[model samples]
Target: MLDDIDFKDYKKKDDIHGTVLYPAVMVAPVQKKILKDIISKNKIVSIFDPFHGSGTALYEAFEISPEIHLVGCDINPLANLITRVKLQGVSQFIFRDIKKIEDYIKKPDGIYEYSFPNIKKWFRPDITDSLALLRTAIMDITSDRNRLYFWYILLDVIRFNSNTRSSTYKLHIKENDKIESMQNTVIDMFLSAAKMNVNKFKHKSDNFILYKNDIFDIIKHFRKNTFDISITSPPYGENATTVPYGQFSMLSLYTIPEYDLELEGWELDNYSIIDNRSMGGSEKSISLTDFELSLIKDYLSLISIRKQKKVIRYFKDYFYFLRELCRVTKKYVVLTLGNRTVDRIEINLVEITKKFLEKNGYKNISSVMRNIPRKRTPRVTSNVYQKPVNSMNYEYVLIYEKNNVTPDREFS
Candidate 1:
């Protein structure tokens, strides 16, 4: 029984934040506020985020309630690195000393290297060599935690020092551009980030953990009825191919812990990866059925013949993922998601999620819609934004509760 508060009134004015590597993230501050309001009612002993992009939700949860044990799980290794660095406080000594090591590497005959094929393409020869040296120096240190901290700093500076202009989230290197000085820039930024992170714990106690594992698998490892609350903003249906997560984040991943593991393909063969249209024309649509109709209408109007199959794939994958999400949660589940329009077809995820939750023995206790104000950025083509109408800006905090959970429920 979530009330329809004025969407325009709750509009968030802050900048939309993406992760260091994953650029497709649409984090509106208003949705975060709504989530905080929902979480305030419960004493969340174990707060979990399956799609913990940028670690904003976990960080906010930690900042608000220090006693809450934050556990974040993500498929991307770079995301895990970001979460780990943000949660685990770094000592000042480690931060200060790392600068010396970084400076030494700038000298001739620097030590270390990652001769991975992919790594070679992105970085200049000297830049790659220098980074390899830095990587070795950090790894040579005995403390695993300190090494992780150093790794995060080094990764954070990759995009800034490269020839790429932040075009979308992926590295689109500018042609005929000089290689930016990687040495001083990378080292200085790392030191600054270290200082900022350490300063956070000077007042409050540090207690948070990040797991570098997929959410679907991580749930199997957890005891039943373990988490008190789950909060996350998962990918939209059509985002897999349209908004490629791995491609955007490959550079960042390489800079952090180089994963030797196989990357799970969520496309083609997998029915779990879903894509769909966004919500555009149906600003007035209310019911789930109406939303679907609106999305289909928009789909017919906007996309080319080539993308027709993908639109269907997006919705199917999304629905299945929702069922899995319902299976894992213990009590409270808060999803921050939005309507995505693919080729003008509006995808109303809230309705789809509500049905899925009800089918999975949960009740849609409440929801708060937050309007995120949009800024008209320079589009690649002038004709793209020639129309007065543009992308709608709003997301939701849908709160579902597991009313059927028993006290004697077994964890197996």
Candidate 2:
């Protein structure tokens, strides 16, 4: 454990990464501070994030060092789009121009013709119509990147306007309540988000890239030892059942016709070149290997409930997915993860990661434990999985180093 290692003082503005409130996917500001502390130790040449949820880590990596190259990979096209917008497309002029565009195109009456039954089920007609109009306006932009940036902020408003108790990241909504004016809420959120992004990246230079593909496939294209740092947070086991990431952002990711609908279940394929499995809801047909099957069976036995089978399958997919990640990383691999329960059994995620490193010729050098003060939910308490919020539980930052470099066995 790196418990004794102390962080030196740094101004919050200098140490912090970009902030994300809508959809609520980025790591907390204090957590980023801890991560930045560790990141400052190395002069990283390049960095990679496999999951890239909301591009939180990549943004922080840039905040730590503007010169380091960054690459982010995610199966979620919406996440990729947002990552690109924050990194490459965002600028002050763009936001100002978008405001002018919105004002010029006054709300057209009877624009409520198109309908999504699912959207209407949750939102009032006026809200849905306003959203549709915003969607149309963003699509009309000439530059693909500029259009995507516009869409990212617009989508951020979707959940903000909802009466749902939680943010969009978790699908569970506060029930039986209606907001008085959905259209107004959506518009306010869109403008606020646009302004935030514009101010945040007003001085950014172009050195980051976003890949809308499975982690495995994206890493396959990189030569061995290509990156100096691999800092990421993989999915938190099957606990993801609480929220459906794809369904939440599908409205925005599909704004363009060029993006394939097939990417929805991307984790299922053996795109051997990419080294990842699909985590999409439509991936019932994908198969697993004997080793992975064993882990899945153990996961099922631990949880011992039929309701969690889908999540267990997704967990299995993520486990194998990490192995592929390790294959591509060069010197340091940093994983920020937490434990969770399935059925009723607890999964020690950090321990699992350590075991993986040991198996792949890596040695655990240090780990930092940080208190998650704002974790609103009760610590999970079951024999299978003990909640970190439980006086005994907390999040961990584990760092490992490659023990040996086998040049002869280098992967092509």
Candidate 3:
């Protein structure tokens, strides 16, 4: 039935979906429909997205049923900020906050407020000055919720004005000519984004909590069966070779104040810190079972011996999350997976995740493979991991129902 629900023309009937540019996001309309179906079956449905990329699923869950509790977390600070601001909703003082920014942008009396290593490499001097002024304006807003909304809108503006190539998630520099021609007056772009998104969050919803911590850190505090459903699109591959969400978010992260991001003081230590800390960022290998290794064995055979360790460890780390996920959700786990090639081979993460979930007491009740008709990535389809290509075709949406069997917690 999910396959029958065509998301090809989900024109974002509301303008909220595109306020920020995250590397990978769930299809808003499709996610809403999925939540609606689940909510229809159950009287009260609480939702959680461990990865919470862009907070798309959580926002959709909030929209479909405003009163239901929605919980989400991500290791990416930018993601947590976006999710928090989104679920925080537009404050009553939104207009006052916009006016505050408008007034500050006119004079920009605040001094340059940010500095990170090689800031000049990604942002020009004038662009940094301009961004610093805008960042000051966002920080000056009276309310944290409104301030967060402006910060959420500022992300794309930073990406747009940065010297980094907007084409890729990596921090590759743009051509000199392109850099020279970049926008110096970034306030116009920021203001435009603010206006587009200003009125969308008119109904303030406070029924959500967001965390900017590792999945385990958040899950350890949650009791068993804390959520009715968990919907998320976990990272397809290691951040270095995959979507690089941390890299994609770095420009904006650097521009915002550390206090606003609720930093633990070392998240911005280097350009790759967040990526290096992501799911498969670790180079260390974990012990995998013969049964677990058997799942990806065929793909590992053709992949280089050195690359095999990275692939093996990524899944093992992912399994750790799935095991905890199975413990928390009471009813269903909804996952949206893509066909990004892991090491030049189109990896079937959906099938692999299905097996992993089954090992944790869930049965794949519904599986839907649909064409990704529109993507903000390089093309209208999903990305070709590591190496960009033009042949990506389908994204699998899987729904797993909790079964009576309790999985053995033998693989710690």
Candidate 4:
């Protein structure tokens, strides 16, 4: 039982160093024990994270047993880049190179020439020039892995120095005075983030195989039952309205050239494409009757017509993702998910997920609710259909074991 597990005392302050360097909804360090405990019980030899945001779950797996093989995939280039660096680990030599590169970046005489549609809106002219200098220096690094690490640092620099409101994941600008008064230089923020990461870096021997493709596409590369355990916290509800991960990351994605390869001639004008391609972004209509879960039906009835479609779309994509997750896992699956609200209606995602897993031939082992002491999500109430609704304060840690019987539906 979770009551017997002392999560409070197990807290490690330094564990967050590498994971929190770049922002997304991250799995807390203390909560990692839930996954670690499951891995220990199953005698797991391999681990996989389909939505490998910052590689927290896989990182915990490596921390538990460094010899375990790790596989992860995310559609976001920045996410892939950050996770790759965290798993690969850094060396003192890389820090030395970063220091040298830092010294080499001198302020340009004129505005650093770069064009993104909202460049002037998000950042000050001087700040943009400083960021361009850092970008150039980081690009000069010879090693792909090391360059990625520095790019992650630059991501932090961009986020901190920008005019974007820090309180929420969705992009919104602060007041002009507030933006103008901010004084942190790009070089200082980059060096600070890099130094902290370098000091905390721990060398590991795990085999990390990461893919920059969508989860739906990457699942095909693995044969059935390739992974012993699958652990992840997938995006909850509609990503466009709820999280806006792509918008939060747009500044960094636009500034960093390495991201351009995956983006394929991405311009600021097509920024909506990122959110549009996210999990719930598919517009294909799903019948409300298609979902067997009662909670989904109840919520669908309460939400507005537009919101009902959004909910249906999110669940449809999630169902397909879950099917693929079951396909690749041999034994255990651990999921950490938050129940969010839409149109003043609380969506019990955890309960719905449990029902879905049971229908798909997995037996529920345990489900525990844990308080989120710290997270990237805003604490304020969100406006849904012009009605104010509070965000999720707690999350569910659900564990399930794959049954030997075949599922009712084919994953393919």
Per-prediction TM-score to the true structure, in the order listed: 0.71, 0.74, 0.91, 0.88
Candidate of highest TM-score: 3
- lDDT of candidate 2 at residue 340, scale 0 to 100: 58
Candidate closer to the true structure by TM-score (higher is better), 1 or 4 = 4
- Write the number of the candidate with greater lDDT, choosing between 3 and 4: 3
lDDT of each: 0.56, 0.58, 0.79, 0.73
Worst 10 residues of 1 by lDDT: 274-283
Question: Could you tell which candidate, 1 or 2, scores higher by TM-score?
Answer: 2
Tens-place lDDT digits, model 3, residues 241-309: 777888788878877888789676778888899988889888544566777788889998988888788
State in Å the error of residue 280, model 3. Answer: 1.2
Residue 125's lDDT in candidate 2: 64
What are the per-residue Cα lDDT tens digits for candidate 4 across 1-412? 3453325554444564443444444455544666556654556678898988777787777777888898888777767767776777765478667776866775333333576877899899889878877777777777666777788777878988998888777678999999889996798878877777675554644588887776766786688899988888888876777777667778888888844335434423456666777788876543434555453778888889988888888887787788778888998788888988887888889988899899888998778787766666765567765766778888788878899733333221
In candidate 3, position 186 carries an lDDT of 86
Ranking by TM-score: 3, 4, 2, 1
Quote the positional error of residue 235 for candidate 1 in Å. Answer: 0.2
Candidate 4: RMSD over Cα atoms?
A: 4.7
**Candidate 2: minimum summed lDDT over ten consecutive residues — where?**
267-276
lDDT of 3 at 111: 62
Compute the lDDT of residue 174 as modeled in candidate 2: 53
